[model samples]
Target chain A: MDIKLDQILFQVLNFGVVFGAIVFLVYKPVIKVLDERAKKIHDADRAAEESLKEKDAIDELKKKEKVRAEKESAKMMEKAREQATELKKELTEKARAEIKLDKEKAMKSWELEKKGEHAAMRKEFVDAVYAVTEKVVGKAVDKKAHAGLIDKGLKELAQAM
Target chain B: MSAIQISISAEPIFHLGQFVVTNSMFTSVLVTALLIVFAVCANRAVTSTSKNSRFRILVEFIIESLQNLTTGVVGTGKRAHLFGPLIVSFFIFILVNNWAGLIPGVGSIGIWEHHGEENIFVPYFRAGTADLNMTIALALISVVLTQVFGYSFQKLKYFSKFINFSNPLNFFVGVLELVLEVAKIVSFAFRLFGNIFAGEVLLTVMTALVPLIIPMPFYGMELFVGFIQALVFSMLSLVFFNMATIGHGEEH
Candidate 1:
């Protein structure tokens, strides 16, 4: 086999040129593309995770607000029930006082009417008695005797008083 | 007697200022120019946004596969990145050189040289790796680059692999390591040259014997051998690089 220095040198130079060109034109660019792709994927993952966290935070806030709203509604409902109870009690007391005043006024009116009726009946009875006495006296005795009896009764009553 | 003849050395085709250019050198130049053109085209085809073309896809596939292969051999971190491009380029160059011999006109078209009333045929093109000079140059580059990687990564610790003087046993071991390091260049050069040259000779013999239909299997075998030899050469370099990057005893 022939070993020539010139051929070895030329081959070395050729290889060096090939190595440099391939590394520059092919290797670097491919690696750069791969790295950029990896970085993009990493960024996307991070963004998705951040969005998920934000969504969870918003959900928690909504839950808290819902709970607060429910609590306020319950409190308002309780207050309204208490106010209704107080209003019902006030109305019942006013109704009872009005019924008591009506009953007292009716009792007083009834007493007055009974007194008037008794007075009228007494007057009638008295009138009838006087008429009967006058008739009997007129029929049985003289008018002068009747008048003397009446004066004698009057004098007795006065003495007894 | 067979009329076919094979030369062991790359035949000189022309001279430029006392510099002789061989048929293998011509092939190497052609391969290099083709690779450069391909690189430019592939670079243009690959864009960040989209890679839909078949050429782009094929180039991307090859780059990814080579990257993965280098990572597998050296490991998956910094050293892989450092040595990946070199090893991949070696593989591509060697594989192309090996396969370039399979072209129809390469071995068939030649100039006939007359020697004492006998006509001897000389081919115009031969595979680059079949030349001992080219393989030797590639081996030198690989061995030297391994040292460069070792020094760049391990710094002062790299010399400890060959300069241990604390004990006689360790010193002898270090000497042995140094000798083996030099031996790796010989092994690398001879292994590639032997395989490719033997393949070329085998094909020549087959073609001479049968002339047709019978050399097909040898051609197929040469193709397989070319691919495997390329893989083997690059893998060995990768292993040596990996060994260089780590501490001496730390290598498993």
Candidate 2:
């Protein structure tokens, strides 16, 4: 029936001390470990996801590089083909010019050879006529015969012209 | 004309340190002893093979019920095994204590004492749970035990909660958490004290006003209230233990 405020306060303080001590010693640790375990798992999962994303990004970059390399190789091959075609055309042009020069030289040489053959044939004709005059005459004549022969050569030359 | 004064006196049955040890206390002690004996003898006879024994059945029922309850609340099988025994013991002991008060003449009988012109019937036997001191003691024990188990389970990391002074906001939050810890103790003590004390007062008033069959309904209500108070006390203790063992981020 006689409840004292001081006694109640004392009991409250006592309980608070006891409760605080136990909480500090016990409850906090248990809950801390539980939270730590949960957080660790969460962090690990996040790390794994990040790593997977990184790997995927690397893979995508690699794919892009491969595609780019293929395109670059195709462009280079096309340029090489174009250069080869140009080189082939230029070489053909040079060869054609050399062949034309050789043909012109051969034609000039043939013309000179024909002119020489004509000169030789004219000389042979003159020599034949002279031998025939000597045989026909069949005389051991001297200046008269030669003068006659010259006069005859002159006539024949005039007639032939 | 004559002036007459009458006096009546009653003798106390037992005494301890200026305080009378009553029948209710006797019942509490008996029940507590019986529970201990049952536990010891049952433990002695217990084997993995003894499945059908009555004591084993009783214990198993209690354990299984606690296990089921905790597991349902906590959503973990591991914690059920660890915290089950305390919860079960608290439930059974408080249940027994609450019910023990309901026995006839527990808080009813008293030693009638006269002082001056007043006759006060001081009760020799008051229900232990009905007393604020006993309920508060039990609540303190429960709350303290919860903290102890929580610390043991959490280990060194438990101190980080209070000692973390990294940021001003965090420091304030930690202080708030400390305040909450004190609040938890208060809540535990007051919840039990309020319920049990109210029940006792209610029963006393009912009986004082109506001495016959009128108090019967109230008595039955008291029995239900007693059971509910015990259940609530034990359940709250169990919940507090569960809460203590689980930190801020730890929930199902």
Best by TM-score: 1
Question: Each candidate's chain A: what TM-score?
Answer: 0.45, 0.47
Instruction: Report the Cα lDDT for residue A49, model 1.
Output: 100
Best by DockQ: 1
For residue B236, model 1's alpha carbon misses the true position, in angstroms, by 0.9
lDDT of 1 by residue, B1-252 (tens): 557788899988888988999999999999999999988887887764574789877887888888989887777788888888988799999999999988878777889988899888878899999999999999999999989989999898898879999999999999999999889989999999999999998988888878789999899999999999999999999999888888857776
Which regions of candidate 1 deviate over 4 angstroms?
A45-161, B48-51
Q: What local lDDT does model 1 show for residue B106?
A: 79
Q: Write the per-residue lDDT of candidate 2 for residues B75-170, one digit (tens) a residue.
A: 666766566555555666666667666677766666666879977566655555554444555666776777786788687666567667899988
TM-score of 2: 0.52
Q: Candidate 1: lDDT of B235?
A: 93
